[model samples]
Target: MKQAIAQYNEAERLARQEKFREARPLLEAAAKSGYGRAWYALGNWSIHGIGCRKNYRQAFECLRKAVRYGAGREALFDLAICYETGKGTSKNVRQAARCYIESMQAGDPEAISEVARIHYWGIGVKPDHSKARRFYLRAARRGDLESAYLLAEMYLTGEGGTTNRRSAIDWLKRAVDSDDAKLAWDAKERLKQISAVTM
Candidate 1:
């Protein structure tokens, strides 16, 4: 276990220094040694082509191992993504929703937001705007910028509750405070549209 931790730690350092090629083998070694986080890192790297060429199949395999090894809630979220997108696997929205729900129950904020999306769109589940709104609220309050933006939209359109412009404006402001330039810009534009309509 100590050897695995050491290898994993060294791999992380190498990755941070942009020495991804050098890190890959070390991560793999740790992963083979039963280090769950090492599997998680390898899964992400395979998906993004960080240290190796993009290989969705490898990513799917590694993520499954990560989940089985208790990599954490994030592993479940990524696995859910794989199921939804069919990245290196069969497309299964029902399974995707199930995994997302499990991760949400495990306290993954991203999973909460995704589950909200499933409910909002009736993706492999019944259309339940109220449940979506509640889930989005939970995610937004947990500091997910995208969730904040979507929740604001829900408030504006009365998707699951009464249309409350004030609440929309508030949530939009929160999204505008995010570091994500696209989301911040959209929130700002939404605020302007509201102002224009009101005036």
Candidate 2:
């Protein structure tokens, strides 16, 4: 195990230097030796053809192995995306949701937002605005810009409960600080609209 980790670390260093060809064999060796992160790295490389040919099937297999070996929360999220989009496996919304929930349990803020999205849109399960609001609030408090925006909209429209304009404005204010130009613009426009209405 220690040897595998060492090999994987060397591969990571090579990869950081853009030595993809030199890193590939090391990553493969580490993965074969039961290093979960190596499996995850190989999976990502396979999916995008970073150093290998694009092979969704191989990506799926590697990612599945990584997940079984407890790769990381990010790996779970990536697996969820693959399941949701049918990138390497069959489209299975239920499985995707399960993976997202698992990732969320692992404290991935993006996964938390995804769970909120699925609940809000009823992608694979029943639409539950209350649950969406709860998840969005959790993600928003963690500084997820998208979740903050969605939570603000929910508060403004009273989708899950009583309308709270103050809460909506607060969330929008938080969103205004986002680095994303579109989100910042949208938040600013909404804030202006709200202010006009109140005036």
Q: Which stretches of candidate 2 lie over 4 Å from their true place?
A: none
Instruction: Score candidate 2 by lDDT.
Output: 0.91
Per-model RMSD to reference: 2.0, 1.1
Error of 1 at 143 (Å): 2.6
lDDT of each candidate versus the true structure: 0.91, 0.91
Q: Estimate each model's TM-score.
A: 0.88, 0.96
- Candidate 2 collision pairs: none
- Give lDDT: candidate 1, residue 91: 94
* Candidate 1: tens digits of C-alpha lDDT, residues 105-199: 87886788899999999887898999999999999899988898999999999999989888889999999998999999999999999999999
Candidate 1: minimum summed lDDT over ten consecutive residues — where? 67-76
